[model samples]
Target chain A: MAEEIEISISPTGQVTVRTIGIKGPKCVQAAEAVAKIIGQIESRELTSEYYEAEGHVSGQIEVRGRR
Target chain B: MSSVILVTPLIIANWSVISAAVLGACGAMGFTVASGAVSGSGRARSGSSVTRAEIEVENSEVLAGGGGTDEEMVVEKDGVRATFSRDARGALKVCMEGTGYSKGQLKQIGQELMEQVTQQYVYHRVVTELKERGMPIVHEEVEADRTVKIRVRNW
Candidate 1:
């Protein structure tokens, strides 16, 4: 999948980013990649897509009921 | 006994940071660092007072959350709930909401909301960065969209 990552810097200096094509923890990897490009973070807000595309960590999988 | 000073970094950054930062309709202004910022615009006929808040991210790896030795966890907030995550591109994303009241014109209201959200937005970002570095947290204060007061000792 060709993911789209968008970053916006407002006139006042606020930065906003939108990533399409990924979700969940993988999206975190995306964020880590981007921040590495830009710099550091002061604050941010993300969308559900981030979680979805990021996918879940295998370590978090839990077995219920029997065993 | 190791005093509070013991936990904090002994050396500070080279740049002088702002003691208090206010994120207006635009982004944040203060501190030597600037990342994850944006501006907001309003229509011609909206009005209302503004409410602000700050979001903090604990347990972050300096490089994983965003970038630099000081990384921030990206997040976005709706009217009440805020979503957090890192983008594939490495940008900290945040979405937030403002008060529902109509206190001024559309433009004014929009500006107020933008400021309120961005302040909290910036708050979360900065907190993430500090935590990633394993720096001791001194103190933090949230004041809606108007401003946020943070005091931390340097390493």
Candidate 2:
């Protein structure tokens, strides 16, 4: 899947960048790339997808039973 | 989504870029560039009766040692006039003057113009840098509130 970067700039000059289809450290890199282009990062939040391994598909369930 | 980041824009560019942003802001606010040659001292005329208000663009720096003119950009709308210039420390400064408007009104206008300038600066920087990075912008739009949104896909 192709990685996508979405950037939103408010009228007041506040910028928000979101990275999709990318996981792990690479996601941080993606955000950093945008920050480098724009300005200093005020805050950042890493979602569950960030904890997943790169190239891992989301929404997978792991079942554990007393078998 | 993987990560979301909030950024505070810092304007650090050459005169060309900064001037472009200033012009864009002026156009958006219904102000016309009056002259490219004007005093940048940020001082009101000695004998003039016009009220003046000056505001600085926050977190901004005009990169020094450029080839552009030292003369400031002067823009006007109605009876009010504004001057866009760089300070000694290379920071962007705006001065608004008008006879009828109160000082508070001039400051408000200066603030609004600065906001628009910042918006235009960030928009140009993002688009230029993304294209340089080989990211193709698949979508772009400006909302009714003047907010800009851009999407780039990295294949």
Candidate 3:
């Protein structure tokens, strides 16, 4: 399965990132790459899956707004 | 199968009234401007009466589109306003109205700010992707929106 990542650039020049794919520190890198494309860095937060997504399932990562 | 993800921009500003930030922010960015006393965008609409602003954005240089018309949207937040639009080639655009600030200068400032914000945004987003999958940040690179994309080469 192909993983997907959605990136958004805010009016304030803020970036919001969300993704669907295999998880872990790897996911962080994915999100970071997008942030850099648009502008600067401010802050970040990891959802619950960031910690639970340990080990893969069916070659895809699940996202649920909340950690 | 090909998958898609929805990313929502998290906005934080001197929002004593909610969308005040949206207007000023959009103005700062070249994509759009603020018109009234308030501004906002992205979120859904409401049946409330308050100051309203409109944002207009388009593929100005036809970088990906063929001289297509710019798209526009209106968002109302805390007596403020906001808007969003996109070009044909997926080149996204945004607008903010209501700031009583510099007319065209806001857009220029926003363009500069977005350059840095986009990088940080990509970094944090990619990190979130990895953690969700229980994987690790094997490698990554984040630049500006048009110049580069977050390429997360996972393991």
- Per-model tally of clashing residue pairs: 51, 0, 80
Runs in model 1 deviating more than 4 A are A1-67, B1-104, B142-146
| True contacts recovered per prediction | 0.00, 0.94, 0.07
Quality of candidate 3 docking, DockQ: 0.06
Relative to the true structure, candidate 2 reaches a TM of 0.88
Name the best candidate (by lDDT): 2
CA-only RMSD, every prediction: 19.7, 3.6, 16.8
Please, what are the lDDT tens digits per residue for candidate 3 over residues B62-108?
13233222433443333333444443444334443334435354454
Ranking 2 against 3 by lDDT, winner: 2
Give the chain B TM-score for each candidate: 0.34, 0.90, 0.32
Tell me candidate 1's interface RMSD: 15.1
Model 3: TM-score, first chain: 0.61
Model 1: docking quality category? incorrect
Q: Please give the CA lDDT of all the candidate structures.
A: 0.35, 0.85, 0.41
What is candidate 1's DockQ? 0.01
Per-residue error for B24 in candidate 3, Å, reads 18
lDDT of 2 by residue, B1-155 (tens): 57999999999998889889999989999999888755445445554678999898879987855635365888999888898888777788988999889999999998888999999999999989887878899999999998899989854
Pairs that clash in candidate 2: none
| DockQ (CA atoms), all models | 0.01, 0.72, 0.06
